[model samples]
Target chain A: MADVNVSTLSHSPKDPAKGAGKLDDSQGNGGIPAVELIELLFFAYRDFVGDADELLARLGFGRAHHRVVHFVNRHPGMRVADLLAVLKITKQSLGRVLRELVDNGYIDQKAGATDRRERLLYVAPKGEELARQLVTLQTRRFARALNECGPGAREQRESSSLP
Target chain B: MADVNVSTLSHSPKDPAKGAGKLDDSQGNGGIPAVELIELLFFAYRDFVGDADELLARLGFGRAHHRVVHFVNRHPGMRVADLLAVLKITKQSLGRVLRELVDNGYIDQKAGATDRRERLLYVAPKGEELARQLVTLQTRRFARALNECGPGAREQRESSSLP
Candidate 1:
């Protein structure tokens, strides 16, 4: 994951039109949307997921694995079909991640009693613990962002600006 | 490439605790931050890059390529070292992507005028076109998100809530 320094990359305060490293400072034609916001969104997402990505890397896992654990823990007994719909990933990809989790004792699979062909997923105790830790790491970041943004600020601004 | 349906995955409106697809309705022990927020962030980022990701795939490129093109276009004449610092990726990884872009006429590399040994990057005409398109697509989404969130709503909420 690329950790961006948005301020460093942004145009200099004194010379907004001429960025330090840029040769062609011409921002394309008029009516072009703000590039600053676009880059900000890009870097924000990169940094947001950096924490979980780092943790998963340490565990020899990846984003796919993290998604599996998070969702399965969130929706234990989730049907294979529903998981496929939610993830929108191929059966093959999900199969590989599921196998690793089950084999490693992070997830448990059981056949639906009523529908024997149905595959149901559940988080094992190990998986639960991992999910908790991941959630905690993410939750802390979320809280900080909310605090920085100021809760209800968007709503208040909306109402305040009303004509 | 996974597209998520956050609303569908969310806890039921009728019974906020129980969800349609979930078998275990038990959200973990106390002090755990909101899972909905966590999932929302996950899906938000997933969808945000999805537009560019889809376009990149058509050209046989990936996120790495998109990032390279974007930053290079933003800072033409940028040294390879500066790019490395901004991206925080392994040299080998960056080298592979850069090779593809240059080979395909999407990027041009020039030696420094002052220090001929220093490699400087510039987006080729084709690359600039692609960058513009990517920026347009992303800007549309960003604009929509701001509209949906209500522009300045967050700021207003922060001020109003203050004593």
Candidate 2:
């Protein structure tokens, strides 16, 4: 990953919209976003996903496979169209990954009960086990981070930060 | 983008290692991760990078290009080897992206100061401008997320969570 900003980051005001106010205006520009925060997010996310990525690599799969297996596991029997919407990827791309998973027995594709034309996705038993492993690896990191941040941090963060 | 855990997430205790103690163990297993937090990270990162991705697409570029431009703009005269280390991508992959950037006039390649055989990279004025645009789009999202989380949130989170 690239370093977006190359400066020693200092504690800046919480809301730049409120300006520097009565404190030191070392940041100089109130409009400038916090560089440290941006870098932190980049690194954190990289390591978070990197854990599952390593396991996926060992299976001769990529992140695409991880994602397909995860979603299918979560929504069991979700329509392929719905999966496409959630992934924001084209059908052509999804077709490639889905085909690979289905062929490899990680995912099972079925016709919708009511509408035979509608394709539904489900994680096979093997896929479910893989999903559990991925969650375990990721959640371990999540747990360690949360624990270090003190009690109530995760709740406060999820409520404040999540969409 | 597949949902990993398909359960309605609740606020679990801050530290599960203590094993739910005096609290209701609705989570059933104290070891289970807070699915909400995992989902939150997934969606947050997706949208975070999605901002730059949209702009990169318009310019006929991808995340790889965005990364190259951002790094060269930051380090100015970093060696190719260093970039490969930071990116953790293969030489052949870097070669493709670097060649494109150089050919497009977004980046300039020069002989290293002392080691003539070393290929050093520098961002051209055009690339620097593009880097600024990418940063602006990303930081706008970053700042808004931080602001919504209230005062001191950024400082506390960055200090506690960063690598």
Tell me the spans in candidate 2 whose CA falls farther than 4 Å from its real position: A1-33, A109-116, A143-163, B1-34, B144-163
Candidate 2: docking tier:
incorrect
By TM-score, the best candidate is: 1
Off by over 4 Å in 1: A1-4, A9-34, A143-163, B1-4, B9-34, B143-163
**TM-scores, chain A, per candidate:** 0.70, 0.71
Local distance difference test, each candidate: 0.67, 0.64
lDDT of 1 by residue, A1-163 (tens): 3233443432211313222122122332233335765665666666667788888888888888988988887777777777777776799989998899899999998887777897778889988888887777776665554443354544443232101
Report the poorest 10 consecutive residues by lDDT, candidate 2 chain A.
A11-20
Q: Which residue pairs in candidate 2 have backbone atoms (N, alpha carbon, C) closer than 3 angstroms, thus clashing?
A: A71-B2, A71-B3
lDDT of 2 at A131: 82
Clashing pairs in 1: A153-B153, A153-B154, A153-B157, A154-B153, A154-B154, A157-B153, A157-B157
Tens-place lDDT per residue, model 2, A1-163, is 2122223112111212211112123433344344435445665677678888889999999988988887677667777877776677899999999999999999987887778997777779899888888877777666555453465643444333110
lDDT of 2 by residue, B1-163 (tens): 2222223222111212211112123333344334545555776677778899989998888988988887666666777876776566799999998898899899998886677987778778788788878877776675555453455643443333111
True contacts kept of 1: 0.09
